[model samples]
Target: MFDHVVFGVSDYAASKAFFLKALEPLGVMLVSEGPLGIELCRPDSQSSLCIRRVEAKATHLHLAFTAESRGQVEAFYRAALEAGGEDNGAPGLRPQYHANYYAAFVIGPDGHNIEAVCHQAEG
Candidate 1:
């Protein structure tokens, strides 16, 4: 539905590090970095998420990324916690959303809700 999204953060370095670790499990990596911002992209090289340094306080936003499998969702949660993210929701199947809606959520360094979701049915 969207091409890309940018998040404004107060502490660029910290937010960058947090995202780098958290998104690693999803195969998202740093595509570009500059004084003002850093961009992360999937293996396809399409920039999907970006974090920009801002003078104003960062605003909280809910962002969700698609995961290829349930294991990736779990890995994202573990990586996010290891990178200093606060737990919002543990990895599990959200039957309320759908039968195969497995997901995990965390609050990032900038206080934004970050999520990884897998829609595939259990094998």
Candidate 2:
């Protein structure tokens, strides 16, 4: 569990756009924004996801957020693509992970592996 997580990126605007689109389907909204960074959170949640501008090496971390349905996962994929995120994996069911395990993966501007997933399929 995280209270908040901040990502350091090369371009603040680009990262902001990527996060906005990818997180839209999850009901995440912009809580705050400035020249330094952008902070987004669920409408009724206190937890925050922050993207800040900085100079650092891109670390490899996979962040998978749950989706209510396969459609939501697919929407995230499309939004991420339109926002300049590189597709790591398309939306699909990975039986190896679980019976449902529908997910989509993308590489954000900071090189972090971002994903949207759902677990609502039968065996």
Candidate 3:
């Protein structure tokens, strides 16, 4: 449970564009922008992810966003790939984590492991 997470991207424009498009299904929107960078989050959520321009290599990290349903996870996976993200894992169950854990993973523009997951059983 973080209020926000900040990270650097080698290509600011590319990484920013990738996240904005890829996270559309999750309702993430640009919240603010400043000299520091840009902040993005869903309108109703206080948490956000901020991307800043940097020349050094980005430190890779896994970031996961909760999905309201399995459909959102599927949508996010497709959108992320179309937005130039590399597929780390396709949308599917990861019963090892939990009986109803369904998720999709993608390597983002900055090599961050981005994921969307739903913990509910399929209807």
Candidate 4:
């Protein structure tokens, strides 16, 4: 039901860097870029991630990324912190989001809510 997702950021350079580092672990790459936004794509997929600079929206936006494992989720959280992201939530299981929903949330450079999640029983 979705063709693509476009996130509005305050600074293109900062948001671009943040996304590059945060999504690198997922095998996503920036395929194209322009003044409007940077287009990203999976290693061999057509779908894209388009990030652009825009006036901050009144409504908060939340984006969730799937991690290959819990470890990746933790790494993403750490990387986000290292990249100057404000901590929203630490990597851990959250029954509220869902049973065995191990995830982490970070405030992106654009001030948008970003999340990395792993949905698997922790055993």
Candidate 5:
């Protein structure tokens, strides 16, 4: 629903690195970077996420990525935690949301609730 989302991160380098590792399984790649910030997006998508280096108080944001499959969700969770993200939720079915709402959540360096979810039923 968003063309792109922009936010400021206090630790630009760390945040950028964390996201690069965490979202790799989701096919998100660095689209561009400059002295001030960087942008990332999936190879097959047009939506982008931008993070800027700024002097501001710590803020929290929830960003969810669409995973193509439950395996991708699992891979994303493992990669995210390996990248230094704190586990907010493990990969599993969230029947509360739907029958096949497999997803995972991680706390990013900037304390954002990052999630990857797949809506398709198991094959």
Candidate 6:
């Protein structure tokens, strides 16, 4: 539905490091870097996630990435915490969204709500 998403951050280096570690479990990696910021993408996807340095402080934004399974959601939460993310919501079934909506949420360095969700039923 989207080609890419860009996040404007106040501290480029810190946010970049946070994302690099946080998104690793999802198989997203740094694809390119520049003086202003860096870009990240999954191995097989054309869509990218870019974080740019801006003079102003970044506003809160909610971004969710798809997870292949519940286990991946759990991994994302763990990685996010280890990478300096604050816990917003722990990994669990969000039955309010749907029966199979398993997800985890974390507050990113720029205070954005980052999430990883899996929409598959548990066997």
Put down candidate 1 lDDT per residue, 8-44, tens digits, no spaces. 9998888989999999999999888887698898978
Clashes of 1: 0
**TM-score quality measure for candidate 5:** 0.96
Where is model 5 poorest over a 10-residue stretch in terms of lDDT? Answer: 54-63
lDDT by residue (43-70, candidate 5, tens digit) is 8888999999989845889999999999
Q: Which prediction has more favorable lDDT, 2 or 5?
A: 5
> Each model's TM-score, in the order given?
0.95, 0.88, 0.96, 0.87, 0.96, 0.97
lDDT of each: 0.92, 0.86, 0.93, 0.83, 0.92, 0.92
Model 3 stretches with alpha carbons more than 4 Å out: none
In model 3, which residue pairs have backbone atoms overlapping below 3 Å?
none
- Which stretches in model 2 have alpha-carbon errors above 4 Å? none
Candidate 4 residue pairs that clash: none
Candidate 2: give the clashing pairs: none
After superposition, candidate 4 runs with Cα above 4 Å error = 55-59
Minimum summed lDDT over a 10-residue window in model 3 is located at 1-10
TM-score pick, better of 4 and 5: 5
RMSD after CA superposition, every candidate: 1.0, 2.0, 0.8, 2.0, 0.9, 0.8
Where does model 1 exceed 4 Å of error?
45-47
Q: Write candidate 3's Cα lDDT for 12-71 as tens digits.
A: 988988999989999998989898789999999989889998899899889899999999
Better of 1 and 3 by lDDT: 3
Candidate 3 achieves a global lDDT of 0.93
